[model samples]
Target: MRRKVMRTLAEARPDGLDPVPGGVRAPGRRRGSGWVAMVAVAVVVAAVVTVPRLWMDGRETTATAAGTLDVAAEAARRQVPLPEGNYWSVTTLISAEESAGRYRVTVTSKTERFLPRDPAGFQLLAMTGLHTRPLTAKDAAAWRAAGSPRLCGDDTDCENDVSPVGRHRYTAMPSLWPLDDSGLTLPLSRLVELPVEPAALRERLLALWPAYQERMKDWPPAPKGAALPTRDTWLWSLSLDLLATPVSGGTRAALYQMLEDLPGVRGLGRVTDAGGRPGAAIAMGGEQLVVSEETGQVLARQDAAASGRVVNAVLFQGAKWVGKLPRLPKGCPKVPVRDTDCVG
Candidate 1:
């Protein structure tokens, strides 16, 4: 799942990171989220549709460049209705604080069981430059039946049986997209108490961009007249920075209001996720965000798949002030890595 092209972005690391290759960046330095790519594909059958990008160019602003709060405040004042559609939502954030509030964020994404065989599937396999023979229908069926092959091993004919003629479809795996700070766990503290005033909050957030630029090695320089590269990028960076930050509820509301003011961001009307959860969606770029109207908490963030379904979906189902951070259970699944964030 390719991210819909957007103008520019300020980068921020997830909580608790040390500057290092493959590590979340330190504070005052731009960083990446730890979760590079997130994914979950189902075997269910469905009609295919072309993916749609729901974004447009928006004026870029600096964190210090104050924005009108009325737009964001309006969003907070009115709960948006959502569309009715089946979709999948996943837990993306779970932060507990000692003597503070625990916050959880969910993301919503889309995926397909399979891609087209001839060009699509074959092209994907060929990208690896490994498979020699052309995949056949039998191989494809077997691959699909086997829940899609995962490279056959010795004593197993999975590779030989389905390697020819592209057995299963290929997916961009939007859910698994990478970010530098995805694994960082934020401390239950705020660097500074966030300001409730929209303009003041914007200025404070903007001040963090210089550090972000210092850390960004290859990202294109931001647009002219813009303190940060792009509005979307800056907001994204801010979101990651604030996800588990021990900020006041007023601060969070201000952030949301600021986000609502961004150009191109608008209500998603009404929509259901693959998980059959109903949410009011906000769309921008190649992503659709489902948020809770009542609490104004972000519920899910999903990417659009090539097949026109949601991908890279995650749900922040929980975000509450807590007394202490929760403890991770032993043997936590390390599918992606060894980190405090992984639940399974």
Candidate 2:
């Protein structure tokens, strides 16, 4: 039955929507599949949202660069009210670049998800307006010099003699997607029970580590004497994973507070995300997050190279409650599969 479910998920997602950075996906699932389902479950958690604001203490606040906004304060003040609706709608823009011969190619795609408030209702997923182009001016020049050949690499959904530019697809999930990965398989109810205070939240998150390690014991052994990550590293990663989901504003504020207490996290002041949205940034090693200055909402999660160049990013455009789903993109038709809807 598990295998059958995995196959169904694979068949349902044909447009190849990538997941957010640092998310742990289950086996037989796409690399970013956990992020997708995690958000669906997030809406369920938000049903009874509204956590009390906690104090932001024991952390040194950093000053921003000139003309930068105070994103930390904005994040700490997050407690957005849950709007009345039957569906939770989220939109994200995914940007990624890959090395191809002499130059690199960048591809961008938009993903929209409408998770029903009712647990039994179907969740709609759509990927549209997939566009691929050269990563930089130098790469574009090189590509033009190379006879402007079609650069179809992995992650491109192009078939024989077809271009990968501007493809769209959609899927309708029959059940509420569970957050299944990283040794944890939590449902919406479980997520809603998490603590809102930074310390309490940290304790609750750390309590799950033992189970994660136990699950890892069954996998292939690490290299001889490979050093495991510190507990703080684990906490940082897991906290960011939760932040990537459609969690409540209070939960998001706690996550921001918790991340600040960890080592290596620094404020990047104001900057533009890959999607061209201006936001304040906080970075920890190669992973970084950008949040809206006005709403403190997470704008994007980026993975950068040692040189600080972003190789992949997932932009959180917006998420809110809606009464109905949007129509499918033109030039796409519906599929006749059970418990599914396709457009594009």
Candidate 3:
């Protein structure tokens, strides 16, 4: 009777199930096969998602290492070459934003071999209209024949003085746009190779300062109760200490310290480039100090609130030295001021 009952159960199979010849599988066991397949699909999906994140992380690491290596190489390549005792005429444009309209100032400097015989040694011959038209050849010739004096007769020779003919021309007109007031100009000779200490550089500057001062002794002084001429003579002396200070990693901490050490300077800050290379900014007599980050040079500087404004802007270029200085040609006369000795 038991055998007959088992045969009857086997003959009546469940839905979607086929009886095996010698084995039996429960319905739950078939469902478990589906679960296993789902698990495999989930694992494959997780692996696909994780692989991209790991690849991106590795790429970012590689990029970071490459950037660091590039920066190091650039720093190493930027070796300061000893400057040849050559001459450079520099013109800088300075503009500042104040409550009043923009103030624009142009400063022109002639830096030649500090020859005793050359009257243009380390001097600013002109500080006037920078954007004005350059002098015509005929007019320049006349201006040179007239001894290249400050004024050709009564007319102010702005062209000849700012844009002098022959060897005294500038190599490029460096613009001080978005004026930072703390910019400085330094001679290439002032930059020393790295690994040299700031103290040593300071000594060299001090040793050379006496001569520099002596050379500038004869420069016309700013008149009492008048604006000081922010020319090379004055600007050079003001930034000499900063220029002399050695820098590490393009940041001149020692120079900033020296500037703060000055009598009137109250505070100092560091200027940095886009890449975080450090520089210096000084506060003097209640004004913001801005310096050029590219060359570690100073450009134009000004005093802050309740104090008078001083601006110096210039541009520089290089040219072949023409024989004999050019003369000023006839042109418009400078606007005269009564009881005031200031010449444009």
Best by TM-score: 2
Q: Where does candidate 1 have its weakest 10-residue lDDT segment?
A: 38-47
Please state every model's RMSD to the true fold in angstroms: 18.0, 11.9, 34.3
Candidate 1 wrong stretches, greater than 4 Å? 1-187, 217-232, 244-246, 306-308, 321-344
Tens digit of lDDT per residue, candidate 2, span 130-231? 566778999899878867766442233234112123654566654344333443345433455567777887787878888877777777876896645457
lDDT of 3 by residue, 261-333 (tens): 4444443344432123344445433334444444434433433333223221111122221223222223312
Error of 2 at 24 (Å): 38
Model 3 residue 239 CA deviation (Å) reads 3.7
User: Model 1, 1-344: lDDT tens per residue?
Assistant: 34332211112323444556666545533111111111001101110111223233443323321233333334544533222112111223211100000111121122221111111111011111112111345544543554442432110133222112222222232221111232222222332266866568777766666666566646566578645345465565455336323355566567666665666565546567544566566555545556555555556556654454664344454433322222323543212122222211
What's model 3's overall lDDT? 0.30
RMSD of 3: 34.3
Name the 10 consecutive residues with the lowest summed lDDT in model 3.
49-58
Clashes of each: 84, 0, 35
